[model samples]
Target: MKQLIKNLCYPLIAVLLFSACGEEDKSISAPEIVGAKLVSFGFYVEDNEGVLDKDYVVDGPIVGSDIEMKIPSKIDKSSLIARFTTSEDNPAVTVKGTVQVSQQTANDFSIPVDFVLTNNSQNNRKYTVRIKRPIEWVKKVRFSEFQLSDAILKVNPVDDVPYVMGITNASNSENRKTVLLKYENETWSMVGDTISNGRPSDIDFTFNSTGTPYVVYTDYTNTIPQTATVQYYDGSSWVVIGRNYNDVRVSYNSICFDAMGKLYVFSMNNAAGGVVGRRLMNISTYNGGSWTTNQTMPGRNYNTYNMRSILKKDILYLGVYDYANDKGTISVYINQNGVWTTLAQGMRMDGATEINYNDLDMDVDNQGNIYIMGLERFDSGYKLVNHKYTASTSSWSIFATPIDLIGNTKYFSIGLNPDGGLSTVYNNLTTNSNSSFVTIDKESQTWTSPFIFPDILNTKADMAFASDGTGYIIYIDASKHLAIWEYIEDNE
Candidate 1:
């Protein structure tokens, strides 16, 4: 009886062990997604009838596909949809935050999609889907007989035309004449009369909502003090915005249009020993009629120089070089309900001993984020620094610097691209004679590789993007002629 019971126990134990081994083997053979692909993509346009569907062909990579998609230039990147396929059927795919196979908002300013795939056994893998703007080529054009020394190129947001504003050597007088050229029909035409009113020192150009061009320039008319005046192009002639305020000595001026089409002009007042001296910055506004002195910027000191200001929406951003203190400061002021309030002041490079700021430029994107770029000196070396004012957080922080940026560089300019990214043009000081161009990748917040234009001796180069996603760089070429490097989508 004992032997029979022991045999029964042994067989039961063997059967139980075999069942456990079988379960473990089954669990080890879990399913997995091997591959994925973006099969199709497009955008939806809403009309009175209904939503119109437009599809795009996907002929790019399969492994973490990097696709260069072309759409209508005016289309917003936030409104894009993508359809994808996986190696195995029923694997999950998601984009932008949605777990839908047909995903929308996948191409929001080059943002990568997170494609999460899960197999039958609940095993998962994630693939990144990148949609890039089509590769573009830079086209070069030389302007004959036009010297672009100390000039600026402004592009029309509506028509994509470029206007060149510069000073040319005058044959009649000892003074230089201000020239404005409009690019049309593949040629640059003089807009109006050559400005010979005063010695053109500095100038700024902007446009209103109705596509009207306005300019503010500093002029020294054979007098002891310089005056700044604002004017607009009225189809054929240049019309002055207001009576020239001659008492205040204007050193630098900048112009910008607000959301309501109202124009604002910021001028640096250089008068000495008066109430106006205490208020070194002056602001003027034009609301379709007369120009009015809106408000004056406070916190004035004799050490302030290289004052630059920009108006975005209702916020005014100001950057000034403090020569006396060896520092550079940026400030912000906002207009809320017709009342101006200072948001920030005296924000400078922290813990820097010697600060020499130059070529200060500022721009704002559609999201109300402000970017200010310039050169600053540090213990390591002189480097280009960008300070960003985030609208969402209401804070100021350092944006980014080029990875290869070196010391001894000058001529820093920043502009907002049509896709709401930032573009920067500067001279590489290490090379001394070469100019460099770089852009910020909105998705990654990283600077693109520095595009160095070799032997570009000039200290200034301006960059602007058109409405059709075309980039234009205006610089003085080796021949001292005004040249434009036009960048367009390179389909090939």
Candidate 2:
């Protein structure tokens, strides 16, 4: 009996030894990350039907300390989701913040992500991922023409063709005629016949979705009482838009088209007196059928001067200069849903007591942000001020002046850029020179160094941008010829 008990005890002792050896082998050790990779990255893009899922993968396996990604230009990069893989299973991967990638306000940006691996041990390995975008601007094409006045250039939003409108000297007669030139095959050619019925005073144009061009211009025909008639080019011939009233004078005739191909014309009228006064602003709309008569806007008092308007999405914004209270004032109005509501009225200069508001120009961005540029006479000198209206907050704030002393500026023109910013050009009367073409950086709320044209003495400068963020500038050169500077991207 004693021998049998010893044998059972020996077997039990052997089993206990095997269990101890297994526990020692299962002891935890430090985890290692031999490799890390971004599997698939994408976001949910909103579409007309619904949300569409867009997925993008890395070019290669993420093997080193850095990973690079390229985002398309002008893309709305907000709310991104990423899938990743690590050397070990179920590794922890996290982006730095609530990752929302957006290039709307900025030209480029960089984002960082982190990955950690662990295997029941205190020591762990981390890997960093970097994403970036690179962009640069290059000068592309320069085109020139001689003996052109009042030169205006516009790009077809559909086909990216450029159209130039100006007044040229008649070949035989001394009278000047209106000419429309289009850029094709790397050369400029006349679109139609040279309009010679009346002298072209002011002109404006817009394009339809299918790249059709429409233009409106004031024809100051040599007649008794001097009736200035408003005419429009209906893709063929110039036809009168409104009736030729007696002694009717139209100035600053601005025309724009909305998203629905509806045309709107804003101009200041003076009848009977045969004088051009910056007051008495009138709006005319063409509802894809026929042109309407002068629809008087609401705040047309005797003291109103320098009225300008711009249309965006179905909203009409009017900026008016009012001197009713002996001091110059600037007011902004909006016409939405057939109701003319005053968004801002009687806005006088905040710093100086006596202010002379000289010129007023208005523009709206794709995001519905409003910008009004005003040239005011202060105690020091002529100052240019920009008032920006934030649509989200429904408020206005004064932007920092790019140039304190405008030096008797004239021919002020402002337009929204393709990258959701603003570009302004003007002629300096005091210096007898043209100011540098200046642009507002929307993301930084700052002005870029004035871009000087190659020909310094250019006049009547106008600026426009294509849908792909390309910029074009047209002006009458020192030789009285039309010239254009194209801003292109250097992708290479």
Among the numbered candidates, top TM-score falls to 1
Judged by whole-model lDDT over C-alpha atoms, candidate 1 comes out at 0.65
Candidate 1 per-residue lDDT, tens place, 297-397, comes to 55444344565555556555555554555456655565544555665566656654544555667777767787766566667777777778898998888
| TM-score to native of every candidate shown | 0.71, 0.65
RMSD of 1: 9.3
Off by over 4 Å in 2: 1-146, 169-174, 184-186, 208-210, 222-236, 239-247, 257-262, 271-278, 285-294, 302-307, 322-328, 352-359, 426-434, 441-443
Candidate 1: segments with Cα more than 4 A from true spot: 1-129, 170-173, 222-225, 241-244, 257-263, 271-275, 284-295, 299-303, 307-311, 314-324, 401-404
